[model samples]
Target: MTRKRPLKQAFALLVVLSIFMVGFRLIPFDEPRISLGNYTIEDGFQLRVIASESLLKAPVSMDFDDKGRMWVVEMIGYMPNLEGIGEEEPTGKISILEDADKDGVADHAKVFLDKLVLPRGVAHVYGGLLYIDGPKLWFVEIKNDRPGKKTLVDPVYAEGGNVEHSSNGLMMNIDNWIYNANYNFRYQLKNGKWLKEPTSARGQWGITKDNFGRLYYNNNSTNLQGDYVLPNKIIRNKYFKPSIAENKRLGANRVYPIHQTSVNRGYQSGVLDEKGFLKDVTAACGPLVYRGGIFPESYNQNAFVCVPEANLIKRNVLHYKGLQITASQAIEGKEFIASTDEGFRPVNLFNGPDGAMYVVDMHRGIIQHKAYISQYLTEQLAGKKLDTLQNAGRILKVTSKTIKPNPIPDLSKASSSQLVALLSHSNGWLRDRAQQLLIQKKDRSVIHQLIKLTSLTNSFSTAIHALYVLDGLNALSFESLSALVNQSKNPETIAHAVGLLERFSARQHVAKMKAISTQLLAQNNETIDLYLSMSLSPWLNLSEATFLPVLSEIEKKHASQGIFQEAITSGLGGKEEVYLTSMNPTDLLKKDLTTAITNRQKKELNPIFVLEKNSVDNRTKGLKLFRSICATCHGADGKGIQDLAPPLKGSEYIDGSMKRLASIILHGVSGPIHVNGKLYQLNNEMPALINNKEISDQDIADIIRFTQNAFAKAGKGISADDVKKMRDKKPSGSGIFTEKQLLESDFEK
Candidate 1:
């Protein structure tokens, strides 16, 4: 009986232990078990996790609302596993994270929206939430943290492309226009109407702006690229593509990762240094020009770029010389923030309302999209078990150690007068938000205050913001703008005033504009000169005799400068020939300008597929496919990006045999191939479209036809039958062809 009692007791203890173990596994731990010790930030700056898993999962981008709550876009379905099998599942969400207990860390998370496929961007604008859900940009009013009155802002906002190459960044600039990266159009909701206009297509992943409103963005390889001039300023002429202003690579690609990085192209020579650290930026994105005031004054205007593949954030010190903006590494061989943990993937950066920098860390193992993932990276990910890290993210706040981040103000409840006063706040984010709120309120009572603020000489950024605010409010007049132009000593303020004066460039305003132009031209200030040159076009359209002399004087003085010349040419627009005829024929600068303008005009006139009806139909279909798919890598103009793809505009491959081109397209080509005599050793393998079940034989044919017609200038195109034949002839094994193999194969059939 005693032996039997001992056995019963043992069995009871085992049963209890089993139940507890099962309960422990079933109990949900919203907070992920991640260690903060994994991070290593630069001295004088501290980084702490403010929001993490359970609160926000796979946060790619985040925007703070007027209540100072974070509206986070979680791309949860991205790269779910090594094969990305369930990535199409609509499991993504936008969660509103709040610090409920008044603690710095987010204690509660309420989902504002869910069932998103891959929502990339979000912004609090127009008293509503603007967010990107896959290809569409949507707006929804928030009532009690729930979406209401949903409206589709743009159905094809991003169109077809992988998340990495699709349009994102719903950033509202100081000009009251909402801009995006990887998109050609800017959006605005004016007087309860949605307005979109074509602008320059910018960077790949993320976009930001400086204090002066010049945008900054980056791509996979380049560290930083920015517009020298303000948005839509230089793209005035449909024919001219300004080289000096838009999409200028302002920083070098050199990178210094603290630890050995698991880059996609690590197998390629020169991708990693001798010490095994990434040699350069391979996946640079989310460039943020630091306008947060909490950082040391030296850190002001510093550009912080996210290199997720390297698990680091690079700091770049930007130097402004007149209109040109350039950047250099803050430290020669170090990073601002680095982590030993491979899952510390910082994908986007934002200046917080609290005057600190917030990093949106998609704390996942695989940062690269499956479409561009390399076999070497696949092996690396598998070897390290990085594919197992999923559904986890962190929003890290970076603040100076000596100076605490300011408490986030509830701008939603702030009065109109208070919002107006905030225009001069040291933090650019607050200043921008204040301007946006003021415009949204449509409070005409503050217009006088804003106009007065524009004339303040002490705060140039404030003045600029105030000027744009007045413009946004539709309160700016010729008298007000001219006053700023005449009274303002700050070149940037005067430059903006000059840009604003274009609205008043009628015959009545021309004489006054010419007088202002003549007076400003005498100063020879490059910034003032550039804006004056760009703005004079409207006046010139009305009275060429009055503005022509003004242009000629500015042109002769600044003829050697390309930016100035470009601006002058931009202003001339339809009067290019007139200006060229007036200039000296012997002038080399004039000859160069004439050549550029003439070539651009010719290219515009000689657009692809002005042929027969059938060819035109094929060309049209092909062009749509090319823009949606091929343009992601080859670029819209077919001039490929560095370390991304070789230029297809004049590629020997495109101009060569149709069969060869078809084969290459069906089964992708690996590079170290020569395009226009320049060797391009691209890191990512050109993916095979044969496996993409969505792309049909006809689609492939159209793409080929488009590439040949548009880029190669070939009159002929292949048929779906030809594409099928090439698909059938695809070589055995992995099916991805190397440059050597493609060159050696006989495609004569």
Candidate 2:
């Protein structure tokens, strides 16, 4: 009887195991749910992702346009949570997807932006679309309903550094004042359309405006978990009016500041629940003014409820300026959506015509709709801003205020004082502005100040401006500028000043240019050499005779550094010159010593040695032959690499020569011949002159001798008599040659 009871229990356990297995297959593990008070939501609000892949794979902010088209802004590459596996991110792109039929799946997608440098923020404004372009914000406005040209707004806002370096938000106010939210706050005044504060103002990220004309924004400096950092406070904002006329009457009036409270702070600070989990608590600013200025004067306020990060949508309305206390209400139960999905994560939010608040859910593949009791909040703010602008002009209440104009004397009228004041301004920018005004001043008193400004500061922009003024006054002299160049540390500034002196008929700057070159040689750093070389390249046009000496000096000092090699290669007008000149190959070849040839080869094969033995000399006949016969394709440097010519380095014909070289020169070999592994079809009429009716084999051998030992190889020389023996050899076209050919050639066997 006991055995029968055991068998029955085992059978029951098997039935329970099978049921649990089926449930596991139906649910994905990461999609956890959130719960509210008495109401339980069952994943209906969860994003209906089309693929099995996780939506947060490359999580970033998203945006939506007026057409309701959703765009997801993702940073490039996978975000690895583990150590040592971090890989470079692929180029980032902004994906614009549309769901025309309201189905959960995306209908079509187009690349809205590409090749962005870590671009994170995307805002869709009514005037045109704006995007985060590396370090700058660019907006493209469509023309005549067609996609329009892009305009660069202010490139950097100095909120915590350059706006380009920080991931912040751009929010538009009711008066069209664009408020830039970094970790700090900066606003554009509606009247001037300029920054309310300088680049120094910083604080907060993510910006939104309430309908009643109050500004709302948040700080991202606070937050925890993961390697990623996020601002702590859910929201922070300021209340400011944008009417210029009204603002003149009131001294910073109608501007107030506000902050949002979190759910964790409201409950369960000291007590732990019996279930080992705290009960659901929620908080988010509610009645947020979408545009500031749409309600009755007193109640025309709106607030952004800080939705608790705890997974539930908590709504609460706090006092506008004072942040007075108030009870919060729950909008949506947590279980309705994925707990990891933050609904308000995307920066853009607006109250729609359907009377429901629309939040852009970038990764979710849909626009989320929230029907709540606080929908009136946005409507009130928008109405309030409109009323303020309309009533601004009627109320002209003037207040006492004064602004000091820049101390630089206006150069438009005063000839002497304007020039002196501008040249004396403490900053380089002011000095430059003054120089321009002096161009029309025709004043002599400012010349000393201009020279002083040039000597005291090496600012390239200011020096150039001062040089122009000197030129106008006929005060520029080689002696004066050379003294300044000697003191200037910035090579570019010195170069520009010298150029001015050279153009002003200063013979002294010419010698100064050479002196500068000498000074450049003393610097050991490659950056200094690169800078000096680039600065001197322009002088090459002065006179090849003058330029050649400098080029030789550069080659002498830095040839071992590779700067000389670039200078040689870049200086050659044609390959023929490169082939014939005696560039310093010894220093370059010494590093790769194994490949360097012995002294015996150099002595025996010197163009002079080969010329005397073979009856062809490179100095006279070889140079004339090069220009007439080889210059067309080989260039002056004999580098031999033209659009059609191949480099002669390691060329088999030159290295193995006499018989092989003579046959091709005599018979004009055609068809595919590989040079450096690249095949090319030669011209059929390649005029050859081995021992042909045209010339003797002796001249041909000496010419080949000159080329073989030149440039990179400095190879062994061939005799003219050796070439005469192979005078009648076949073309040897259309086949790869073997070393045995040299042994079997008539010149050998």
Candidate 3:
């Protein structure tokens, strides 16, 4: 009996040990959900409605006041009478909603402001709310219990002094001065008005102010701008990689705009006057040139910094007050939440009450889908119990309480052993956080620790997080990544490690990425799934030029996968002209140009050209047409880039249908349209493209076909019959087309 009892105890112990070992895979490894203890999570987190909500019909941007009340900007036309208000452009008005009970749902909802003239960007300055209405800068001050709006700048001045009235992005510095991004408006704003400020770059939707008062705007281009004073001193480096710049380019893939950081002094300037109020245009960063880069290695100080898309949430060094200022990775990471939020399109970073940054994604998408808004509001109002990932597009609170970022350890004073001990801590967050801090502190002595962390199989996930830290730290080296890949046995871990490598110049990591990819492919382990090939193409490997044929075949085979297909198509779409032997890059570039030119043309012309010819023809005629007609609204190259004018090329709408096209040109699209899968509001008043009785139906049809085939290859070879059908049975001018409506249209076929 004693011997049997001992055997049973041994068997029970083995069973318990087996169960515990299997539980590691089930551990909740998601980013920690922490609470500040004082301001509950409900205080900041907002509910989003991307999938439902009818009244919120195309919510684009949102703004908040000192009282914490929110004003949502809806893209669809307003229901003034709620009985029969005809749909019209400038479908403009503002909704004021309040959550007095601390619930995410609004306790009170009504139209707070109305009759806005195509308002795009909104911000708060001093005690009033500011909005960009056409060429005028207007503000409404809240007094007693009512709101009153006043024009801060004259419409004529803003229009005549500048290129156009539309403004896409806006921001207010801590000192209270406002900066506006005039979708392709590279002009100057002087004395409460705008003027021609010529530059090679076009401004897109992002504008932010750094602590030093430098205003950074996302210039929608890869072509570097030439120096104003020293015209010949043009920097060859691309500041904003076009593939990553502007919402339209990236929106197609469901990715937001490139995250960028800039100083306020770069574009406009402000200072606290004697009255302690903010004033505009005090100084520019032009004269404050630094020789090195933005951080430790190169601090080249020049006026008007152009931030690339990759550095968003990545650590960057900026020159402020003649001192190289260091911004922590946490500051950059805040944008991830703001970027993910749907309501906050055209988001601008603002200092919140908690002394941290809060971004209000313009309520463009929110207003478009009211059902989603209702459900989202319901979930949010319910204390965020419905913590679904789809609600990423909400009002994100970046208070210090949300993210308990580790304090930066002064590695300069710490011993190597201490550094390793900190990095190898049992807490994964602590260990990863320490590795990031060490990279930033940049003490080479810690290299041994980094190398050791790379080799430890238990630290594979820890090492992946550390690589992103290295990327922000600018400590990523080809040799280092190669060493890590050699030791890595886990496929998922290695996939993340490969993703970081894609950020560097393609030429630099090609060899290492190729070798790692080759090794990953050979692994037959069922648990070893590789997502890295999604970012890989045959062209990535530089050293093995002889293996190009094999790689090309491999790329062709993998191109069928969703991720890989998207990556390759997006990459090709980004190029000005990409040439593959099987299919010429020139042909694709020409097709894009023809699509761009015809989409902008008042009347379609069959220019007897292929992609190569169209590219040449567009360089001449396209620029003129763009400036005279399209530039005033959509901007050159059909980015529909204005705060008011809708983007045409790459526009999901223009890629199909002649009905919406005819309405926009003849009657005009009044509200928001989902283009590139992101909703955009043209704000009504597009100055009717046709004098209804003048243009012939045939001409319109030709124009329709040309535009349909211009931007996306999927839209090629559309027929005029399609145009006639759209023009005949189009929706009444009651509201802009809905995503459901567009999807339901026969044109989708």
Candidate 4:
């Protein structure tokens, strides 16, 4: 009996050991564990991990639905390792994160959509979810967290660009239009149909808007770039690209990292400080104008920028004057949020429904795209074993220490009247979401309440939201707008009302508008005058004699301000010749205005030629390559990014000789080169493409054809054989060609 008992005990022990080994094998070996204590935020603020690995991975962008649930875009395939192998695999996904327990942390994650390739942007708009997957923008109705009735909003939405330079930030503005960065188009869904229109090409990564509806974005180097004026205001004459208002750099490129930073170009002189910290922003992106009311009043409207390469977030205080906006760094030699943890990559920022600033941390060591990867960066990444950090991401919530965040409200279930009432909410996210819902529902039942809300002079933001909502619903009437124009003491309200009054600029309302214009001219407010000048086009179309004098007066009063002159020019539209002919030639602004008007008219008459079908195909392919590869330094418009490449549009190198251009493309050019008479002394040499096996000779020819057609006088055909000859005649010692050498080369023959 004793021997039998011992045998049974031995069998039981074996079973227990087997169970232990099996359970241990199920543990995740590769998942990286992050410590929240590694972060260092500014005083009076706290950062907490709301979601992390196992719940989400490699989140680049996110949007909140009407229910306050977060829909995150996971770019899982982005730089999975140092080699970036298998990046083309469809591993990206859009996930719905919910804090069902309400403990201020996201514990439940559901894959809303999967099998996406490098999905970059997402927005909840027009009773559907809009998302960008690679080159296409798609709209899918979300039925019970599942996709239904998928629609292609745009096929070439963000085509040809690698993830670094692709269009992102699917932000829905208060003007009822969807805008993106790195692309030159805006989208809208009006009455069950999609409308797409050309807008000024904006920043490289994330995009945002202020409470007043002016867009704000940034590139890789500049900290902040925003429009001084509102949307579609200055772009009236497509030929005249105004430089004062749109895409203006608002802040300096200075950055302050708390620790020694790891940057892609740290080896480059002036990129790193003496202390080995990032001296300036090398990867400044994802700018957000904070309107979350949870912070102190001084924090309102301040711009917070994400600098992932330095592992920091910067704060810029925005100063608003009469008609200008400028931003300065909030603290000297410090950052808003900094971390010693090199893996903390804050790629994007957002305003949460609960009045907190939510940060999307990609949590990967390699933030630089493979296309732009430098040898110095590759070595630095390898030495630190940083390239091994992948498949980890987190969503962090930042809130003020003194103020507690309120519970997020589920506006998806709110009635129309209830939604209208929330338009005045102190939280900008709530107000924006409320207005969006009201417009999407198209419920005119609350139009009367919205009209009443527009009259609330005490709540300027609420009044603005109400006015735009009314405009979106097509409920705005001439009577209500004119009343607001005449009675509202707020300059911003009056400006918006005047701009909206253009919809009512008919012969019957001419006299009333004329009277209102005269009354507004008497006020002498620059803000009101600017919008008045913009809104007078239709009235000028009807009675140029009466409205032209009003525009002239505005021009003469604010003649020193270029924005006002542009506004007046925008108001003239097709009648620029009449205004110029009537104005005195001796007027100080007349010469510049006449030049602008003449250039615009010239462009309108001589439009770009339509290429042949075959030529068009090649040009299209070239454009894709240019945007993906060259647009990083040379802007998408060929107008060169500041501190990077020189403008390619009117360069002598582009227009001089086709063979010289081809040689420069085959073997790159180093500059102190004069491009359009401006000397560009760039820090880094343009890397030679002769050794890049991925780019074929035909690809080089296509690029040449594109630059010639788009920027030169006409397209000059350069066959693949021509490019091959240029490649074969590689300069001795295999170095980039200097401008002197290029100018003296026989390739021009």
RMSD for all candidates, in order, please.
11.5, 31.1, 23.9, 11.3
lDDT string for model 2 (333-421, tens) is 22212233322223233332111233332222111111110112112223433112110000000111221112322233555655555
**For each candidate, what TM-score against the reference?**
0.80, 0.30, 0.32, 0.80
Provide the overall lDDT of each model, using Cα atoms, as 2-decimal numbers. Answer: 0.81, 0.38, 0.38, 0.81
lDDT of 1 by residue, 123-168 (tens): 9999899998877899999875668899899988876566777789
What is the per-residue lDDT of model 3 for residues 685-745, given as tens digits with 9 covering 90 to 100? Answer: 5554444555455555544443443333343333446545545455444444444555665
lDDT of 4 by residue, 1-749 (tens): 45554764455445445545664211111122456686788899998888888788999999999888999999999978754557879999999886643556776577888899999999998888999887789999988678889999988887755778877888988778899888778899988899988777789999999888899999998999999888887766554556777789998999888889778768668988899989988888889999888999899989999999999999999999778899998988889999899999999999989999999999989998654555457667879999989888999889999998878888989999899988988789999989988988889989889988877765327889999899889988899898888888788788788988888888898889989999999998988888888888878878887888888888888878888877776666677778888854235456546756777667642111111111224555676677667778887556788778898767888778787888888788776888877899987777778889999888888787767655564346788888888887666654678888887789844
Better candidate by TM-score, 2 or 3: 3
Where in model 1 is the C-alpha error above 4 Å?
A: 1-34, 583-749
Q: Write down the lDDT that model 3 would get.
A: 0.38
Clashes of 3: 71
